[model samples]
Target: MPNTQRLLTARNIWMATVRPNGTPHLVPIWFIWINERIYICTAPESIKARNLRANPNVSVSLEDGNNPLVVECTAKLLDKPFPDEVVRLFKSKFDWNILTDDEYGALFEFTPVKWLLG
Candidate 1:
């Protein structure tokens, strides 16, 4: 098996959440992997954020098709004054500060419940 950390360094990841009507909403998003959790920042009114507020269940996957890595997680909305480590990592990886960003202010932390790595 390949290193999970290496897979996570990809520029973007595909995340899927269930809408209120039980339909799937999927999009590619920038994310940071910390410890064993996935962290994301998006607009509060975005479809993904709204869906997660109603239903915390979510799925995320690396974009590479040859070596697939998928994870099922429960989403948690993080309050302002986000963790220092998370902020630093985001700056290092994406060079954007979520705290000062108005559009992508809504932050989420996803805890993996299952993993499918092939």
Candidate 2:
């Protein structure tokens, strides 16, 4: 199981993925922890989404204030899309009610390949 407690309260993390040309792309994203999974959502057409599709390898960092623990993953967008549980949890925890149904349709789900609490 993931270190659910730590990740759930983490304010933000730098989500890093490799670009097609071999450089890293990093962006700060808010994430939610559910069950044994760390769930994050992003537009399916985003650059990071495209990069992830090209190379499923990704890394996310959660910090204890300024100190960071990095988790690595190889993610695949779920064919079935985000389930209602995910949507509810996401909105409840993160206040993401901004997304309309059409926007929500663009979401993708990712799972961690590995996590390192350093």
Q: Worst 10-residue stretch by lDDT in candidate 1?
A: 1-10
Model 2, residue 31: C-alpha shift (Å): 1.5
Candidate 1 on 1-118: residue-level lDDT in tens? Answer: 3357754577788999999999999999999988778899999999999999999999999988888888889999999789999999899998999889999899999998888674
- Give the least accurate 10-residue stretch of model 2, judged by summed lDDT: 98-107
Give the TM-score comparing model 1 with the true structure, all chains together: 0.94
Over 4 Å off, model 1 = none
Error of 1 at 111 (Å): 0.2
Which prediction has the highest lDDT against the true structure? 1
- Clash pairs, candidate 2, are none
RMSD of each: 1.5, 2.6
- Model 1 lDDT on a 0 to 1 scale: 0.90
Question: Could you give candidate 2's per-residue lDDT for residues 52-85 as a string of tens digits?
Answer: 8899888988756466577786666655546777
Question: Residue 98 deviation, candidate 1, in Å?
Answer: 0.5
- Candidate 2: which stretches are off by over 4 Å? 1-3, 98-105
